[model samples]
Target chain A: MAMPFEARYRVYWHHTDGAGIAHFSRILAIVEQAEEDFYASKGLLHVHGRLPRREVYASFLYPLRRGDEVLVRIWADEVRRRAVRYRFEILNLTAGRKAAEGHVVAVCVDSEGGELKAVECPQEFVEAWKEA
Target chain B: MAMPFEARYRVYWHHTDGAGIAHFSRILAIVEQAEEDFYASKGLLHVHGRLPRREVYASFLYPLRRGDEVLVRIWADEVRRRAVRYRFEILNLTAGRKAAEGHVVAVCVDSEGGELKAVECPQEFVEAWKEA
Candidate 1:
């Protein structure tokens, strides 16, 4: 199990929908951004490693309005030889309530070369995720 | 079960991310647009009834490149008294392949007055979905 990582974000007007709350589809950006920040914290990047997932599942608990501050926490829920699953918990930091949570599963892929193919999880990635 | 509704869309440049393919996050716009078009075909608008759902699950089968043409099909998978679940299938018509599919579950809410609260599915909505 890996420790969860957190980051803060402010909802902008563009994130809202006709409903006046954050659009559920747009939440993908928020979660993916947190995932990127999590890797950057460890001095890693998508260019250094590529793990593209095919599936995403999320549940929104509260409506996030524009100007709302959020605390998004992410962690590896499961790790396999060639795939990893991550969980995200988005909180209304101002209101101190959970707004959404979800999981994303990505498989290791060799995007460095011309053709992208599924690959085994690199040792450095596994080590960084588990040990650090 | 409601019959599936479909609409055609062309991939725009803004939908692409650094990956050069359609950004996963931006796919929301495509799906939501389809949803809106589906309703509009029946002379319905988001303002007609507010169904705000909190859950979304999606799977991308293929990467959608810019300038691609897509066919998005949506249908009601389940319809409850106060909630409805929709399924979306996005096909890359240009490539003759499936790009992605997902499910969105939204609950009915009353926004006419003040204080958004979950409400029962209106008769008109149920009738509109079934009859039309």
Candidate 2:
């Protein structure tokens, strides 16, 4: 099995809610940042803006407060002709435990001529994941 | 069966992503706004900030772009002693179709004295759902 791409981030006030913990929605954004970094590491920044999420599921295990450091790990769980499913885990380093984990299914689409059409995954993504 | 509470909103540039559609994460925030309004309608604003999400799932069916009007409907799916599962649907009025749908499972917790403890759902929520 290949090692998952990892990224670290610190929770900020804007990422949290009135409950003083990171808002559940922010988890998706954080994992997306890690996904972007993963693609950038492979010199495939262009892969962005094409893969829109089709489905997402997340479970929160531990709460993360503002200023808490988190480690996000992501890897391809499944690859299809026009979609990819990525599994991600977020660890709350301050609490020494898993904060949240989830999977996102993103479908590749082409938005040209004022219409959105499903497209096959880019060659760059296939090659990058293969190399990883 | 009871009718679900509904709220209408317009998608803005800030709510969209590079894909030219609403970012997947923003769906949760938008539904949360509707949830807050539902509570407020029942004079239960205090219910906010107490129920933190334990799990959430969303499936996007159709794309929603900037300036698109959306109608969000939410209702209690299941209610336990210390948790509630709320089902939600986001309809794209511009596209005249279901844009996204999902469920959120939130656990009631008491955050006092700098500690968080699981607690039973408030009586206000019970009454509100009963009325609904």
Instruction: Report the number of the highest-lDDT candidate.
Output: 2
**Candidate 2 to truth, TM:** 0.95
What C-alpha lDDT do the candidate models reach, one value each? 0.78, 0.87
Chain A (candidate 1) TM-score to true chain A? 0.88
Q: Write the per-residue lDDT of candidate 2 for residues B1-132, one digit (tens) a residue.
A: 677999999999999887778898997799999989999988888887898899999999988899999999998888788888889999999989999999999888998875578898888797676555
Error of 2 at A56 (Å): 0.9
Task: List runs of model 2 lying over 4 Å from the truth.
Answer: A130-132, B130-132
- Regions of candidate 1 where Cα sits further than 4 Å from its true position: A111-115, B111-115
Task: Say which candidate scores most in DockQ.
Answer: 2
Cα RMSD (angstroms) for every candidate in the order listed: 2.5, 1.5
CAPRI rating of model 1: medium
True contacts kept of each: 0.78, 0.98
Give a tens-digit lDDT track for model 2, residues A40-122: 99888888788888999999988889999999998888888888888999999988989999999988889887567889988
The DockQ of each candidate is 0.64, 0.91
